[model samples]
Target: MTFIPIAIYWIIALWGLFSRRPVLVYLFFLSLPFGSFAVVPPALTGGLTFVPTPMTAMLMVGRTFLDPTILMRAISSALDVRRLGLLTGFIVTALVSTVFMPRIFANRVMVIPVRGDVSTAAPLFPTTQNISQMAYLLISFATVIMFSQILKNARMQQTVLLALTWASALTVATGMLDFASQYLPVAPLLDPFRTATYALLVDVELTTGKRVVGLMPEASSFGSLCLSLLCLLYFMRRAIDHDRVRAFYAPVLCALLIAFAWLSTSSATYLGLAAFFAMAALEWIMRFLDSRYNLLRKRYLKAEFAAAALAVVAVAFIMLLHPAILENVSMMVDRMVFQKTETSSFEERNMWTYVSLNALVETWGLGVGIGGTRASNSAVAAISNVGVIGGIFYFGFIIQSLLRSAPPDDKRGQVLIVALRYAFVPTFLVGLLIGTTSDFGAFGAFRYGMLTAIGVTGLYHSSRMRQRRIAVSPESA
Candidate 1:
């Protein structure tokens, strides 16, 4: 079964890598939902299950590195210099932490490993996890450079956008099928796709109904996937090139991803959804203010107005006419968010964060290294794995990217810069609650790269399609 999925991935990966078109862009985005499908079996990797997206990321990095000019161009810019510097500092911290901190605090701290019996935290030690996690961290860091370089070309940027739109649609479709298969006799039919060595929590449930794990190993991951896509698609829709994709496909997929995430019934997803609403509201308000006061309006401002109006009408209708809908929503939120601490899952996850944070302090802030501990919080996971210096470097990179001021002429760059910033918040907030590793995974690196490419090129001069100018025959100026 694993072989079946691996073979399919190979075809996609190979085609993407070798093709003239930006197939690798499509491959990267489409491969993300298969969190449970480990491309390399644990037995082959000596207990490390290398999943598709990370493997694809490594391949993308390798492919990018093959071009000597990318590094040449990357290093020429001050923004790229800082990005590389910060990431270099981050990796150095991880290396030092993996080598020395694990040994220094080996028996001194307790942690729940990313693998092994996750039921309880144990005294930390040097393990294979440290090595594998370092590799993953390296791959993620490399991905930022790889993708940023790739996005320098206008065609590649458009391809990535299209790929994300399609990937979101595919993700929603697969999750819906998974949800429907529960009532049908076809649940086992989909099992072949979920052959990862990790324990698959596909059929977990809350008090209401079966949690929609999709093809992911667990409900939280599946929900997070949906939430991330929803944010990306909604926030970055204007950057998409095609009218059909931007106006119809992306919007429909966003609605479906939102619906599927709700069905997943994850507490983190609920919090993320709330965060999404808040952030979207804040962004819209800011844009509105910018348009009214500063004359710094966005390209598709009317859509935001229309969406906001629809949301109000929908909410009013749901409250006034379909009161039961509001009651059900309230109960869901109650179970998932307000009363989340009461659940055993919450207790277990809480322990993971507690022990991870303790490991941080226990190591005197040296950090126990990546994969030395499992954490339910991204901040705890990031800082605890690499210590304060590494944490600062990692977070500083994010802030730097967000703070980048694009040239006034680069409209696409400016939109992507602002959109990606807001889009990251919902998912990052969710990761703070249930994230396991310091790695932001591939999609995050992709977003970072997209933003970085603008900074890399400085003015997006490689873009051939941004112009609709008709030249006058006589006038040179």
Candidate 2:
């Protein structure tokens, strides 16, 4: 049964490799739902489950090196001295922290380790977990670089959007399967894919009801995955090249993703939803205020405004007729989000962050290494594990990536930049509360890489355009 997933993965890999164009992007996004499926057994990888995303990323990295132009373009995206310097320093510091710092501070600090019995904080020491996590971090970073190079072309950008739309649909399909599996017996079919080394909490239920985990290990993972897709599809819709996809398919997928995310009953996802809507509202407000924007057309504004007004009227009418319905929703929100802090799960997560942060202080901000400590917060996890110096370098690199200037004349590229930025915030916010590891997942790496790639390509094109204009100018003669 397990062979089914492995066979499909290899077939896709071979197809991607032989293809003339970069099909890896399509394969990467499409393979994300198989998160629970380890292509290689844990026993072979020393109890570390290797999933499809990372495996595809490895293929991408190989592709990046195989083509000289691709390698150069990837490097050129970070050619800026400050960006390059920060990235290098981050890599160096993180390597040192992973290899040496834990041994130096062995037994001196208590931390929630990447692996082992993490019910409580344990004494920090060098372990295979550190090496494994560092390896993951490096792979994620390399994936980012590889994506940046591949995504520079406008055609490739459209291809990615199409891939995302299909992937979003698949995500919805998986959630539906998960939801119906409770009543039906088809969940056994999904079992073949749930062969990860770690514990699988797929069937867990929250007070609200069944937590829809989809094909992931837990509700949180599934919910956050939905949230990420929701953000990308919703925010990036205007920039989608295909009219049908942008108008119909994208909207449907976005709606389904939101529904699945809510059904997951994950507090982290709820927070992310709130963050995403807030950003969306802000975008609408901006669009309403200014009509000359690059991506978001004013044509959609009337429908959106009309929808908002209709929704308001309907809500008011519903409240007047059946106030109990409103109360039920409020209670659900309170149960899923507002009262989350009182739960034991929240307490344990809070402690993970607290202890990991204290471990940072214990190591004098040199960090306990990449996998040395665990935290519920992504920021704290990154800073605590990498220490203040590495954090500075890492964050600087991130900021540099996110703040890349779009080409002034390139509307599609500018819209893409806006979409990526707005899409990133929800994921970032959700990760702050429930993220377990410092290493941003493959999806995150891809987004970051795309951001840099878009910006760099825009700059290069704009520069060339300017040079062409100058060459034709009479002043040059």
Candidate 3:
């Protein structure tokens, strides 16, 4: 199933290499997971078996971890090369282990499992896992910027924007479908849609009914995506213009994503959404102040006003439909300020933050090596003891970059860039502060790539926009 699409990718990679396009190489590398697992697999897996079970999709998605296997297989078949480095590596490692640890082997040695919120004994391509994880971390922040740059130079910007808009729209739609199917009545003997829909809606809980992950990875991830989409839509509005009729879908998508997130009953995710909303709101307020205080020129003020108003109306509608924002905020207030523990999440985060802080004391300067984030038996211990300081440095680099790169343009642009910059910082803090409670953020390549893409892309676009503004500005006169 993986071979055919992989063949096409190899062809493209060769073509890209032949063309001497290093960026294409980078993009091709960035795209392997999404391409092999995300795009081409439907035809491959769908064709292999008449029935496309959820497990197949999961397996394909899971292949992101085992990309080394895919790479090796592709190399051996396509290049017909024998004894690739990995084979030599396996032999050398096995020899070293067998010779040095013969007694260890005689004891029927057991492999100590890596601690994490979740664990799977099944091996993924270990090498690919590491490579992809790093790639994602580096690439996520660049994607948006690159796309924006491409749009700036190319006539294809409209098509690209439409594609991205559509992808986000579909994600919103699928998530809503998942949410609605959850609440709607199920009839077993009815048609496939009715039966399948009913099955998706069944109530299930995790951690002894303490966690409800919902259709998304977790409720919080779903909420974050929804909230991020809303922000993205607002940000992109100036770039793409359309009739008022189609513009309505933007708000509708945000509301639907939030609604589904609420139904999932993910308190942490809701908290994340609230944080995002607050940041966005603060941006709006800043823009308003700038407009009032002569901080922004009269030229862009009207567009800013329209954006702020649209954002507010959309948020108001979302809040009206799902009042959980208040409920979640109240729960947080009661817990944090009032000094009461309402849920495990609250308790876990606090514990982890303490531990992480202590860990920072021990490893204060240089960071712990890679795999430092490997889970500990306890969340707090894992965070603080297992290289807490290093994590801080890692996150600090991100925070500092955000602070430094934010556009210093008109008040509106400054506020918008600053707000966007701070958006993910809090989420990262939550994962850190919340402790080792779970491996929510650092688990897979896809999400890591996503974060990197958002960060890099945002920074790149802001710089470009700033340059463009300067290039044409009257200030140069």
Candidate 4:
């Protein structure tokens, strides 16, 4: 009997992997248990109530109490570890790339040929990195692995893109339904829908009404995810330009997603959005400048110019329509610019920054493990937190990657690229500087995790650009 239930989960997981359908994958993820009751076996489902805070911990503990064979049978039978393994490989490669590739490229300074021209440049990111920075680099490497492997297989890429598209669509649908749920009476049949739908809208101030946070923990995170998805949509739109149906819907959906982000009033999210837009603009500007004035035109400058113009206009318009967003942003900038010593949060952050420096000197090159807290006379113990030297290292890596990745010749390009690439930098910097005064290493893994994901995307994009250029050269042609 137990084997039967285990078999079901395995079967579903396997189907999800092999089918390689993006829509199905999105459904699978979103449909997965968000509560302990849903996660519990159907036979035991009725008894569960509280949702676990650390989902992975719950899974591990659940498997421990459950029959080992049953757990193994389910996990091994359904899911594709090969995909996971490939993802791991990509991350490992990224790590190596981060640690050595930059230094090698710097040393070699070879004139690697581009389309119709010879080019030589140093790689993105340097060999020397701080511990916190290393952590983000490693995580970024992992995300790249996932993106590359998934995209490498045509079927998988299609599946992923489709899933991402539909997932984006579904999020929109869920948000709408959530808004509608606020006014209407709930039908028993629509009870589940109501719960799922309404859960997305959040109350920012209990009295001032709720803002839409969606399935994410907060409005800001939700907004950030939407912005990330918008980038994905932009990629999809580029790929599916010929498909009028998808092309039309993609832009509309992207607009809606942006609107949701705006409504959330997450200032940090704007930084990321701005960063991506700035990167897009830089790419466009470079191509345009090259075409108009280059000794030889190597890339499509016209397309870049058009794209950049569109992006700039779209961003400007979004801001123009939402004056409240500007107000919020101004207030935030003012807070940061004229920081006061009176605020306890600000004061504590200053203390932590100093503490991290002290800890760094005490540790002297070796870092405490990721999310480690020691009771002994370690620097972390003395500081009563994750320590600043580590924070500096982690934050430093993000900055380094951005600097290394920016397009040559444009200072604006360099700054924008850094801001986008190191999207988590400001937030983490805020968390370190003003938001949370404590050592956030243990508490704020998500911020680091996001940095990891973004870094991997940037690295993968860099590698792909090189691959595309290399593949199209003389011999391949």
Candidate 5:
């Protein structure tokens, strides 16, 4: 049954590969969330695991190379050569370390795990797994760059966002169905193939029985993808021209995504949710203050004050009836946030961090190798796997890109860019706990790459627009 979607996907993908119209390629990008079940058969391709997203990325990169003009234009418009050089240096350093680093350092073992306990162990040097990881990273980087070039104008950007919004809506609907299937006897008939795929890919023990894995490999992964889409939708809403139907569906989709994240029972999702709401609240306060002072509207001010008072009263009332009324809330907070620190999972991550630090010290900050240690944290992984020199280039490239992609004076674009930048704060902080910079297979990396490309492309267009405005009105400037 899973073969059905896989077959249809290949049909479309092949058409896209051969067609002159770019719409098919855009459709392929938007449909990546559905690719979890579109896996290639292990018997073929020498037992190499292949998914549609990465396969499509490889095709796109090949297409770019086929047209040197497109590749050169994209590089010139979307990238700063200096930053590109730094990125190249980082990649080269990793390659060099993989070749030169020792296989065994005092009998220490380096394991590269894809999911759960399934992993490949090697010594300090790069194994086949490490090389595969490097390939994934390069593919991901090329994919983002190609998409950024393709989505140059405002119309293209809007098209991509609209496609993304629809895709997210579908994903949320599927997740809700998955959750309902747990209780409904006839739910299997609604999504038979997806249900089967979930059974095949999901680790039942880790999901805690109630969490919905959706179309992703696990509940946590689905939650991460949802969180990322939510952030994108929130920012893109401000930049795109509004439609009544889209406006109506946007909030409903957000509500569904939030519910799905909560039901996934991932602590990382909870933390991200907390951070998002905090930023939203802060933005709301700033807007309210700005309106109050600039517009000087007494009615609006009075309404705002009344709302604040009501919130205060509600909190006080809840506190007064705390023991019985808030027991469930307190218990949830304890389980999701507080008590998590005492769990074995937290201890394991701590142990990984300690080991990574020791590796860094032992190697004199030169790193062990590309896949030498399992740090479970991006910053630690950078130091331990890539060494200090590579880490500097790696982090430096990201920071420089963010700085260079500052939005121009367009109010809507500025607001969107600012929000997107703030959204990255929580994601980056979370990565320090359980992600790597070069983890190409994860949805988080995909989201990060997409966001970065959007910022850079938006800034490029915004700068051009600003220049035109200046040229038109020299006296005003």
Candidate 6:
């Protein structure tokens, strides 16, 4: 049953490849959030499990080879000696660790508990699963490199952002429908399709009885996706043309996203949202203070101060008249935040982290293998699986990519870059909790890769444009 969608996807992907329309490839990549069907390849059914995203990534590699232009460009970009060195070092270390280190340190079997069930043991070693995981990780890295070359146009960047916005809206709508299914008959109609897409379970809040998982494997994953997209949408909103209808609808879409995030009821999502808003508010406040003093500024600040005063007064009134409301809020926070540390899920994550560190120690900092330890944190997973050397290269590549993508002199672009940079803090924190090195595969890697590529490309073009202007000027010479 899962193979059906996988087969259909390949059919379309092959058509796109032969037709020389790379946009089709890009579209397929963008649609990965909806491509969760899991299938086992007949040839290696016992050894390897195939997911649509990794399959698509392999197809993309094939497409690149078929089109020499893309291959050439990717090769040219790779010629940057430092990036090439880092990438090569990382890949070599991962391969060596996966093949040799595990066998050398074969004295211990690393046990990682599965989520939802604490007693079940999932052991890790240099098995076929680890190899397959390494393959997928490599594919993800390759996809990011391919996209950095392909998504050079500002228009393409806008198109990708618009596509992501639509996907987010759809995810929120489906989630709402899933929630309504508890009380409404028609809502269940959507479940079959969702199930086929690999969303096997619906997560419901115990307190509110509201369903939250949407296309993702779990509620927390869905919430994480929403938070990431929300931050992206907020930063990219200004880039959209104000004269267009999308601009009019953009705020509405943001509101819907915010509502979806809240409805997720995931603590991590709440933290991410809080961080994003705090950064945004800080930026706004700084901007407000820096602007020339005028009647509008004074009135705006005065209104803000008045609103704060009113909020305090209202809070006092509530404390005096409706003490239960404050008590309930505190209880809710305790349940949602403080109490989480006592849950089995929290224990499972901590166990994974502990096992990961142990694995790192067992390997003597040489690493066990990629996917050799089921650590919830990417940094821990990287260090434990690929060794300290590989970890440095892996994280170094990300930092270098971000630095290269730094916006130029354009004020709006610079502001957008700052917002995007701050957004990474929350994403990183979430990754530290329960994210893979590929950041949950193409769903995360591709989106962030495109954003970085777009920023870098835009900055390059901006510099070129300025150079051209200066070259044309007579006074400068």
**Against the unseen true structure, what C-alpha lDDT does each candidate score?**
0.81, 0.84, 0.38, 0.40, 0.61, 0.63
**Which candidate order results from sorting by lDDT in descending order?**
2, 1, 6, 5, 4, 3
Residue 52 alpha-carbon offset, candidate 6, angstroms = 3.8
- How far does residue 204 in candidate 1 sit from its true spot (Å)? 1.3
Predicted structure with the largest lDDT when compared to the true one = 2
Which residue pairs clash in candidate 2? Answer: none
Per-residue accuracy of model 4 over 1-477 as CA lDDT, tens digit each: 334433454465445444534433444334322221122343454322222212222222243225566445334322322212322332333344334433433333221111112122222223222233345434333333233223333354335445556666766765554445456652222233222211233445322235556545456556655666565565334433236535467767877876676555554555556665665566445544543343223233454467557877986898899988678667754543344445564454344444434433443432222222112122233122223443344334434333343223333323323334433333333232223222232112322322232333355557767887889899878
Given candidate 3, what's the lDDT at residue 422?
48
Query: Candidate 6: lDDT of 359?
Result: 70
Worst 10 residues of 6 by lDDT: 292-301
Model 3, residue 232: distance off in Å is 2.9
For candidate 5, give the lDDT: 0.61
Which of the numbered candidates is closest to the native, going by highest TM-score? 2
Candidate 2 residue-pair clash tally: 0
Q: Which stretches of candidate 2 lie over 4 Å from their true place?
A: 76-79, 82-85, 291-299, 314-323, 456-469
- Judged by lDDT against the true structure, how good is candidate 3? 0.38
> Which of 4 and 5 is ahead in TM-score?
5
When 5 and 6 are scored with lDDT, the better candidate is 6
Q: Any runs in candidate 6 off by more than 4 Å, and if so which?
A: 1-15, 18-32, 39-49, 79-85, 109-124, 186-205, 242-246, 286-330, 405-416, 436-440, 451-477
TM-score of each: 0.91, 0.94, 0.49, 0.48, 0.79, 0.79
lDDT of 2 at 124: 91
Worst 10 residues of 2 by lDDT: 76-85
lDDT of 2 at 245: 92
Candidate 2 lDDT, 1-477, residue by residue in tens: 888877878888989877877677788898887779998877788788888888889987896679887777667645554334466577778998998988999999999978778779999999988888888888888887777776787888888889999889888988898899979998888898899988899988756678898888899999999999898888778888688998788877887898899898888999899999999899888777874755444536786678778878998999999999889778878988999989998999999999999999998889999899899999999999899999998888778777776666778877778778888899999989998887887877878777777775345557777898999999999
lDDT of 1 by residue, 1-477 (tens): 557777888988898788766767677788888888778767877767787888888777777777788767655532444445676677788888899887888788898888988889888899988888888888887888787777877777778789888889889878977988868887776787887777899988666788998889999899999999999888888887798888788878888998999998988999999899899889888786674332233655687679879989989987998889888889988878999889898899988999889888888888898889988899899999999989998888787677665555777767777888899899988988888899887867887877777753323433322332324334434
Runs of candidate 1 exceeding 4 Å displacement: 74-81, 291-297, 456-477
